[model samples]
Target: MKNNLTSQQMGKIKNLFADRVRFNKVERLVYSHDMGMMPEQVRALIQCTPDAIVQPISTQEVINIIKIAQEEKIPIVPRGAGSAGFGGSVPAKAGIVIDFVRMNKIIDIDKEDMTATVESGVVWQNLEGELSKRGLTLRTYPSSSDSTVGGWVAQGGNGYGGYEYGDFRQNIVSVDVVLPTGELKSFSGSEIDKVYSLCGITGLM
Candidate 1:
Protein backbone atom coordinates (compact mmCIF):
# COMPACT_ATOMS: atom_id res chain seq x y z
CA MET A 1 0.00 0.00 0.00
CA LYS A 2 1.05 3.58 -0.51
CA ASN A 3 0.51 6.74 1.47
CA ASN A 4 -2.63 8.82 0.97
CA LEU A 5 -2.67 10.82 -2.20
CA THR A 6 -2.27 14.59 -2.30
CA SER A 7 -5.39 16.67 -2.98
CA GLN A 8 -4.07 17.42 -6.47
CA GLN A 9 -3.72 13.71 -7.21
CA MET A 10 -7.19 13.03 -5.86
CA GLY A 11 -8.59 15.86 -7.95
CA LYS A 12 -7.28 14.20 -11.08
CA ILE A 13 -9.01 10.94 -10.11
CA LYS A 14 -12.28 12.71 -9.32
CA ASN A 15 -12.23 14.61 -12.58
CA LEU A 16 -11.71 11.42 -14.54
CA PHE A 17 -14.10 9.18 -12.60
CA ALA A 18 -16.92 11.56 -11.74
CA ASP A 19 -19.19 10.08 -9.06
CA ARG A 20 -17.64 6.64 -9.31
CA VAL A 21 -14.85 7.77 -6.99
CA ARG A 22 -15.72 8.27 -3.33
CA PHE A 23 -13.56 9.88 -0.64
CA ASN A 24 -16.10 10.55 2.07
CA LYS A 25 -15.04 9.38 5.52
CA VAL A 26 -18.10 7.14 5.92
CA GLU A 27 -17.56 5.37 2.62
CA ARG A 28 -13.83 5.06 3.21
CA LEU A 29 -14.45 3.36 6.54
CA VAL A 30 -16.88 0.94 4.92
CA TYR A 31 -14.29 -0.30 2.41
CA SER A 32 -11.63 -0.69 5.12
CA HIS A 33 -12.62 -4.13 6.42
CA ASP A 34 -13.66 -7.53 5.11
CA MET A 35 -15.28 -10.72 6.40
CA GLY A 36 -11.91 -11.98 7.60
CA MET A 37 -11.26 -12.99 11.18
CA MET A 38 -8.67 -10.69 12.69
CA PRO A 39 -7.33 -10.51 16.23
CA GLU A 40 -9.10 -8.00 18.46
CA GLN A 41 -5.87 -6.18 19.18
CA VAL A 42 -5.07 -5.74 15.51
CA ARG A 43 -8.61 -4.78 14.60
CA ALA A 44 -8.93 -2.28 17.38
CA LEU A 45 -5.64 -0.56 16.75
CA ILE A 46 -5.48 -0.50 12.96
CA GLN A 47 -8.40 0.30 10.75
CA CYS A 48 -7.38 -0.09 7.14
CA THR A 49 -9.07 3.04 5.87
CA PRO A 50 -8.46 3.38 2.19
CA ASP A 51 -7.77 6.84 0.84
CA ALA A 52 -10.55 6.34 -1.68
CA ILE A 53 -12.96 3.78 -3.08
CA VAL A 54 -13.37 3.52 -6.84
CA GLN A 55 -16.15 1.46 -8.39
CA PRO A 56 -15.54 0.63 -12.00
CA ILE A 57 -18.47 -0.68 -14.04
CA SER A 58 -16.65 -2.08 -17.06
CA THR A 59 -13.30 -3.36 -18.30
CA GLN A 60 -12.52 -0.01 -19.86
CA GLU A 61 -13.15 1.76 -16.57
CA VAL A 62 -10.89 -0.75 -14.81
CA ILE A 63 -8.17 -0.09 -17.35
CA ASN A 64 -8.51 3.66 -16.97
CA ILE A 65 -8.39 3.44 -13.17
CA ILE A 66 -5.29 1.24 -13.29
CA LYS A 67 -3.60 3.68 -15.60
CA ILE A 68 -4.22 6.54 -13.20
CA ALA A 69 -3.09 4.54 -10.17
CA GLN A 70 0.08 3.42 -11.95
CA GLU A 71 0.91 6.95 -13.04
CA GLU A 72 0.42 8.16 -9.47
CA LYS A 73 2.17 5.16 -7.90
CA ILE A 74 -0.91 4.31 -5.84
CA PRO A 75 -1.32 0.84 -4.43
CA ILE A 76 -4.67 -0.65 -5.38
CA VAL A 77 -6.69 -3.38 -3.69
CA PRO A 78 -9.06 -5.13 -6.08
CA ARG A 79 -12.06 -6.37 -4.16
CA GLY A 80 -15.13 -8.48 -4.87
CA ALA A 81 -17.56 -9.54 -2.14
CA GLY A 82 -14.85 -9.44 0.53
CA SER A 83 -16.02 -12.85 1.86
CA ALA A 84 -12.77 -14.84 1.83
CA GLY A 85 -12.43 -15.31 5.62
CA PHE A 86 -9.05 -13.60 5.18
CA GLY A 87 -8.18 -9.96 4.72
CA GLY A 88 -7.15 -10.44 1.11
CA SER A 89 -9.13 -7.39 0.00
CA VAL A 90 -8.03 -5.15 2.86
CA PRO A 91 -5.49 -2.56 1.81
CA ALA A 92 -2.29 -3.02 3.84
CA LYS A 93 -1.61 0.68 3.27
CA ALA A 94 -4.12 3.44 2.70
CA GLY A 95 -4.52 3.72 -1.04
CA ILE A 96 -7.29 2.95 -3.52
CA VAL A 97 -9.93 0.22 -3.32
CA ILE A 98 -11.34 -0.90 -6.64
CA ASP A 99 -14.69 -2.28 -5.64
CA PHE A 100 -16.07 -4.44 -8.43
CA VAL A 101 -19.70 -4.95 -7.47
CA ARG A 102 -20.96 -2.85 -10.38
CA MET A 103 -18.84 -4.78 -12.86
CA ASN A 104 -20.81 -7.97 -12.21
CA LYS A 105 -22.17 -8.71 -15.65
CA ILE A 106 -21.79 -12.19 -17.14
CA ILE A 107 -20.28 -11.41 -20.52
CA ASP A 108 -20.63 -14.73 -22.30
CA ILE A 109 -21.85 -18.30 -21.83
CA ASP A 110 -20.79 -20.82 -24.43
CA LYS A 111 -22.82 -23.95 -24.31
CA GLU A 112 -20.63 -25.59 -26.93
CA ASP A 113 -17.41 -25.12 -24.93
CA MET A 114 -19.21 -25.44 -21.60
CA THR A 115 -17.56 -22.22 -20.51
CA ALA A 116 -18.62 -18.79 -19.40
CA THR A 117 -16.88 -15.44 -19.82
CA VAL A 118 -17.75 -13.24 -16.92
CA GLU A 119 -16.50 -9.95 -15.61
CA SER A 120 -14.47 -10.45 -12.44
CA GLY A 121 -17.22 -8.95 -10.31
CA VAL A 122 -19.84 -11.60 -11.13
CA VAL A 123 -21.15 -13.76 -8.27
CA TRP A 124 -20.79 -17.55 -8.48
CA GLN A 125 -24.36 -18.28 -7.39
CA ASN A 126 -25.75 -15.97 -10.05
CA LEU A 127 -23.68 -17.74 -12.65
CA GLU A 128 -24.77 -21.11 -11.30
CA GLY A 129 -28.41 -20.09 -11.59
CA GLU A 130 -27.94 -18.83 -15.11
CA LEU A 131 -26.12 -21.98 -16.16
CA SER A 132 -28.78 -24.20 -14.66
CA LYS A 133 -31.39 -22.46 -16.75
CA ARG A 134 -29.39 -23.57 -19.78
CA GLY A 135 -29.20 -27.14 -18.48
CA LEU A 136 -25.63 -26.74 -17.21
CA THR A 137 -23.82 -25.93 -13.98
CA LEU A 138 -20.40 -24.95 -12.82
CA ARG A 139 -17.87 -27.75 -12.27
CA THR A 140 -16.95 -26.15 -8.96
CA TYR A 141 -17.69 -23.10 -6.86
CA PRO A 142 -17.04 -21.80 -3.36
CA SER A 143 -19.38 -23.11 -0.65
CA SER A 144 -20.05 -19.43 -0.21
CA SER A 145 -21.39 -19.25 -3.74
CA ASP A 146 -22.10 -15.57 -3.26
CA SER A 147 -18.40 -14.91 -3.53
CA THR A 148 -17.39 -13.10 -6.70
CA VAL A 149 -15.70 -14.92 -9.57
CA GLY A 150 -12.65 -12.67 -9.46
CA GLY A 151 -12.30 -12.95 -5.72
CA TRP A 152 -12.41 -16.77 -5.81
CA VAL A 153 -9.91 -16.94 -8.65
CA ALA A 154 -7.56 -14.45 -7.00
CA GLN A 155 -7.48 -16.16 -3.59
CA GLY A 156 -6.07 -19.36 -5.06
CA GLY A 157 -8.06 -22.41 -6.16
CA ASN A 158 -10.00 -24.28 -3.49
CA GLY A 159 -13.78 -24.73 -3.24
CA TYR A 160 -16.77 -27.10 -3.41
CA GLY A 161 -16.81 -29.89 -6.03
CA GLY A 162 -13.04 -30.14 -5.77
CA TYR A 163 -13.15 -33.92 -5.24
CA GLU A 164 -14.73 -34.32 -8.65
CA TYR A 165 -13.98 -31.44 -11.02
CA GLY A 166 -10.92 -30.07 -9.19
CA ASP A 167 -10.42 -26.45 -8.12
CA PHE A 168 -11.03 -23.11 -9.87
CA ARG A 169 -7.68 -23.10 -11.65
CA GLN A 170 -8.53 -26.31 -13.47
CA ASN A 171 -11.90 -24.98 -14.59
CA ILE A 172 -10.70 -21.54 -15.58
CA VAL A 173 -9.68 -21.69 -19.22
CA SER A 174 -8.23 -18.19 -19.39
CA VAL A 175 -8.37 -14.76 -17.84
CA ASP A 176 -8.26 -11.20 -19.19
CA VAL A 177 -6.24 -8.90 -17.02
CA VAL A 178 -5.09 -5.32 -16.62
CA LEU A 179 -1.42 -5.48 -15.66
CA PRO A 180 -0.09 -3.33 -12.84
CA THR A 181 1.60 -1.10 -15.37
CA GLY A 182 -1.86 -0.60 -16.96
CA GLU A 183 -1.42 -2.88 -19.94
CA LEU A 184 -4.20 -5.26 -20.97
CA LYS A 185 -3.33 -8.89 -21.64
CA SER A 186 -4.90 -12.32 -21.84
CA PHE A 187 -3.41 -15.45 -20.29
CA SER A 188 -4.40 -19.04 -20.81
CA GLY A 189 -3.15 -22.62 -20.35
CA SER A 190 -0.05 -22.90 -18.15
CA GLU A 191 0.57 -19.19 -18.35
CA ILE A 192 -2.46 -18.49 -16.18
CA ASP A 193 -0.70 -19.81 -13.09
CA LYS A 194 1.76 -16.94 -13.16
CA VAL A 195 -1.10 -14.45 -13.52
CA TYR A 196 -3.02 -16.05 -10.68
CA SER A 197 -0.07 -15.75 -8.35
CA LEU A 198 0.17 -12.05 -9.02
CA CYS A 199 -3.49 -11.66 -7.99
CA GLY A 200 -4.45 -8.32 -6.45
CA ILE A 201 -0.79 -7.53 -5.76
CA THR A 202 0.50 -7.11 -9.29
CA GLY A 203 -2.60 -6.65 -11.41
CA LEU A 204 -6.34 -6.42 -11.70
CA MET A 205 -8.24 -9.74 -11.68
Candidate 2:
Protein backbone atom coordinates (compact mmCIF):
# COMPACT_ATOMS: atom_id res chain seq x y z
CA MET A 1 0.00 0.00 0.00
CA LYS A 2 1.11 3.55 -0.74
CA ASN A 3 0.42 6.78 1.13
CA ASN A 4 -1.57 8.97 -1.23
CA LEU A 5 -2.36 11.79 1.20
CA THR A 6 0.00 14.72 1.59
CA SER A 7 1.32 15.83 4.97
CA GLN A 8 -0.83 18.98 4.89
CA GLN A 9 -3.93 16.98 4.02
CA MET A 10 -3.23 14.56 6.85
CA GLY A 11 -2.93 17.53 9.18
CA LYS A 12 -6.30 18.85 8.07
CA ILE A 13 -7.93 15.46 8.75
CA LYS A 14 -6.20 15.24 12.12
CA ASN A 15 -7.61 18.66 12.98
CA LEU A 16 -11.11 17.51 12.19
CA PHE A 17 -11.06 14.01 13.75
CA ALA A 18 -8.45 14.59 16.44
CA ASP A 19 -7.11 11.22 17.71
CA ARG A 20 -9.69 9.19 15.84
CA VAL A 21 -7.60 9.03 12.69
CA ARG A 22 -5.52 5.95 11.85
CA PHE A 23 -2.51 6.17 9.49
CA ASN A 24 -0.47 3.09 10.24
CA LYS A 25 -0.15 0.50 7.48
CA VAL A 26 -1.39 -2.29 9.74
CA GLU A 27 -4.47 -0.36 10.75
CA ARG A 28 -5.23 0.68 7.19
CA LEU A 29 -4.77 -2.91 6.02
CA VAL A 30 -7.42 -4.05 8.50
CA TYR A 31 -9.88 -1.83 6.69
CA SER A 32 -9.00 -3.15 3.27
CA HIS A 33 -11.31 -6.14 3.40
CA ASP A 34 -14.79 -6.99 4.60
CA MET A 35 -16.57 -10.25 5.54
CA GLY A 36 -16.40 -11.54 1.97
CA MET A 37 -13.30 -13.15 0.57
CA MET A 38 -12.25 -11.81 -2.79
CA PRO A 39 -10.58 -13.89 -5.46
CA GLU A 40 -6.79 -13.70 -5.56
CA GLN A 41 -6.77 -12.28 -9.06
CA VAL A 42 -9.22 -9.50 -8.20
CA ARG A 43 -7.37 -8.71 -4.99
CA ALA A 44 -4.10 -8.51 -6.87
CA LEU A 45 -5.52 -6.04 -9.37
CA ILE A 46 -7.02 -3.55 -6.92
CA GLN A 47 -5.48 -1.49 -4.13
CA CYS A 48 -7.92 -2.46 -1.41
CA THR A 49 -5.76 -1.09 1.38
CA PRO A 50 -6.80 2.39 2.46
CA ASP A 51 -4.41 5.26 2.97
CA ALA A 52 -6.10 6.17 6.27
CA ILE A 53 -9.06 5.21 8.41
CA VAL A 54 -11.15 7.81 10.25
CA GLN A 55 -14.02 7.47 12.68
CA PRO A 56 -16.46 10.39 12.68
CA ILE A 57 -18.97 10.88 15.50
CA SER A 58 -21.43 13.06 13.70
CA THR A 59 -22.98 14.01 10.38
CA GLN A 60 -21.21 17.37 10.42
CA GLU A 61 -17.89 15.55 10.68
CA VAL A 62 -18.83 13.47 7.62
CA ILE A 63 -19.58 16.67 5.70
CA ASN A 64 -16.18 18.08 6.63
CA ILE A 65 -14.48 14.86 5.50
CA ILE A 66 -16.28 15.03 2.19
CA LYS A 67 -15.07 18.59 1.75
CA ILE A 68 -11.46 17.59 2.29
CA ALA A 69 -11.70 14.59 -0.04
CA GLN A 70 -13.34 16.72 -2.71
CA GLU A 71 -10.63 19.37 -2.50
CA GLU A 72 -7.87 16.79 -2.80
CA LYS A 73 -9.73 14.60 -5.29
CA ILE A 74 -9.35 11.55 -3.06
CA PRO A 75 -11.72 8.63 -2.85
CA ILE A 76 -13.86 8.45 0.31
CA VAL A 77 -15.14 5.01 1.30
CA PRO A 78 -17.75 4.87 4.07
CA ARG A 79 -17.86 1.75 6.25
CA GLY A 80 -20.14 0.41 8.96
CA ALA A 81 -19.21 -2.72 10.93
CA GLY A 82 -17.67 -4.16 7.74
CA SER A 83 -20.11 -7.08 7.97
CA ALA A 84 -21.08 -7.21 4.32
CA GLY A 85 -19.20 -9.67 2.11
CA PHE A 86 -19.94 -7.96 -1.21
CA GLY A 87 -16.90 -5.65 -1.05
CA GLY A 88 -18.97 -2.52 -0.84
CA SER A 89 -17.19 -1.28 2.28
CA VAL A 90 -13.70 -1.87 0.99
CA PRO A 91 -11.88 0.66 -1.17
CA ALA A 92 -11.19 -0.29 -4.79
CA LYS A 93 -8.41 2.35 -4.80
CA ALA A 94 -6.18 3.57 -2.00
CA GLY A 95 -7.89 6.44 -0.18
CA ILE A 96 -9.63 7.45 3.05
CA VAL A 97 -11.85 4.94 4.83
CA ILE A 98 -14.49 6.60 7.01
CA ASP A 99 -15.49 4.12 9.71
CA PHE A 100 -18.81 5.02 11.31
CA VAL A 101 -18.43 2.96 14.50
CA ARG A 102 -18.13 6.05 16.71
CA MET A 103 -21.40 7.42 15.35
CA ASN A 104 -23.41 4.51 16.75
CA LYS A 105 -25.98 6.50 18.67
CA ILE A 106 -29.69 5.81 18.58
CA ILE A 107 -31.01 9.33 18.23
CA ASP A 108 -34.70 8.72 18.77
CA ILE A 109 -37.39 6.06 18.89
CA ASP A 110 -40.98 7.02 18.21
CA LYS A 111 -42.99 4.35 19.99
CA GLU A 112 -46.32 5.52 18.74
CA ASP A 113 -45.11 5.81 15.17
CA MET A 114 -43.04 2.63 15.45
CA THR A 115 -40.07 4.35 13.98
CA ALA A 116 -36.50 4.80 15.09
CA THR A 117 -34.05 7.53 14.20
CA VAL A 118 -30.44 6.47 14.43
CA GLU A 119 -26.97 7.28 13.23
CA SER A 120 -25.51 5.29 10.35
CA GLY A 121 -23.32 3.30 12.73
CA VAL A 122 -26.16 1.89 14.81
CA VAL A 123 -25.77 -1.89 14.90
CA TRP A 124 -28.90 -3.92 14.27
CA GLN A 125 -28.45 -6.14 17.32
CA ASN A 126 -28.00 -3.16 19.61
CA LEU A 127 -31.02 -1.45 18.16
CA GLU A 128 -33.03 -4.65 18.56
CA GLY A 129 -32.08 -4.85 22.22
CA GLU A 130 -33.10 -1.25 22.79
CA LEU A 131 -36.35 -1.75 20.96
CA SER A 132 -37.06 -4.95 22.88
CA LYS A 133 -36.72 -3.08 26.14
CA ARG A 134 -39.48 -0.81 24.94
CA GLY A 135 -41.67 -3.77 23.96
CA LEU A 136 -40.86 -3.28 20.28
CA THR A 137 -38.73 -4.93 17.63
CA LEU A 138 -37.77 -4.31 14.06
CA ARG A 139 -40.03 -5.70 11.39
CA THR A 140 -37.06 -6.77 9.30
CA TYR A 141 -33.33 -6.93 9.79
CA PRO A 142 -30.25 -8.36 8.09
CA SER A 143 -29.12 -11.94 8.68
CA SER A 144 -25.95 -10.59 10.20
CA SER A 145 -26.92 -9.40 13.66
CA ASP A 146 -23.87 -7.20 13.84
CA SER A 147 -24.66 -5.31 10.64
CA THR A 148 -25.24 -1.59 10.87
CA VAL A 149 -28.57 -0.11 9.89
CA GLY A 150 -27.01 2.17 7.31
CA GLY A 151 -24.94 -0.65 5.89
CA TRP A 152 -27.93 -2.92 5.48
CA VAL A 153 -29.94 -0.08 4.01
CA ALA A 154 -27.19 0.75 1.59
CA GLN A 155 -26.65 -2.89 0.61
CA GLY A 156 -30.19 -3.31 -0.75
CA GLY A 157 -32.07 -4.19 2.48
CA ASN A 158 -33.19 -7.78 1.88
CA GLY A 159 -33.00 -9.92 4.97
CA TYR A 160 -34.80 -12.03 7.61
CA GLY A 161 -38.09 -10.22 7.27
CA GLY A 162 -38.23 -10.04 3.52
CA TYR A 163 -41.01 -12.59 3.31
CA GLU A 164 -43.43 -10.59 5.44
CA TYR A 165 -42.40 -6.95 5.78
CA GLY A 166 -40.55 -6.79 2.47
CA ASP A 167 -37.17 -5.12 2.00
CA PHE A 168 -35.91 -2.29 4.23
CA ARG A 169 -36.92 0.33 1.72
CA GLN A 170 -40.60 -0.39 2.19
CA ASN A 171 -40.17 0.32 5.90
CA ILE A 172 -38.08 3.46 5.49
CA VAL A 173 -39.73 6.77 6.29
CA SER A 174 -36.95 9.14 5.32
CA VAL A 175 -33.22 9.71 5.39
CA ASP A 176 -30.87 12.64 5.94
CA VAL A 177 -27.90 12.42 3.59
CA VAL A 178 -24.83 14.45 2.76
CA LEU A 179 -24.46 14.52 -0.99
CA PRO A 180 -21.16 14.24 -2.91
CA THR A 181 -21.16 18.02 -3.39
CA GLY A 182 -21.24 18.53 0.41
CA GLU A 183 -24.89 19.41 0.42
CA LEU A 184 -27.12 17.99 3.15
CA LYS A 185 -30.60 16.97 2.05
CA SER A 186 -33.56 14.96 3.34
CA PHE A 187 -35.38 12.46 1.21
CA SER A 188 -38.56 10.49 1.82
CA GLY A 189 -41.35 8.69 0.00
CA SER A 190 -40.52 8.12 -3.64
CA GLU A 191 -37.49 10.37 -3.43
CA ILE A 192 -35.70 7.87 -1.20
CA ASP A 193 -35.37 5.61 -4.24
CA LYS A 194 -32.62 7.96 -5.40
CA VAL A 195 -30.32 7.26 -2.46
CA TYR A 196 -31.07 3.63 -1.53
CA SER A 197 -28.45 1.05 -2.51
CA LEU A 198 -26.30 3.68 -4.23
CA CYS A 199 -23.29 2.62 -2.11
CA GLY A 200 -22.49 6.23 -1.21
CA ILE A 201 -22.19 7.36 -4.82
CA THR A 202 -25.18 9.69 -4.43
CA GLY A 203 -24.47 10.59 -0.81
CA LEU A 204 -23.64 9.47 2.71
CA MET A 205 -26.68 8.52 4.73
TM-score of 2: 0.97
Question: Could you tell me which residue pairs clash in candidate 1?
Answer: none
- Which residue ranges in model 2 land beyond 4 Å of their true spot? none
| Candidate 1 whole-model C-alpha lDDT, 0 to 1 | 0.84
* 1-205: candidate 2 lDDT, tens digit per residue: 5698899999999999889999998999889899989888998998899998999998999999999999999998999888878898999988899898988999999999999999989999999999999999999998898988888767776888789999999989999999999999999999998888888678888
> What value does the lDDT take at residue 123 in candidate 2?
94
State every prediction's TM-score relative to the real structure: 0.92, 0.97
CA lDDT, every prediction? 0.84, 0.90
lDDT of 1 by residue, 131-168 (tens): 99999998999888888998877887777889998878
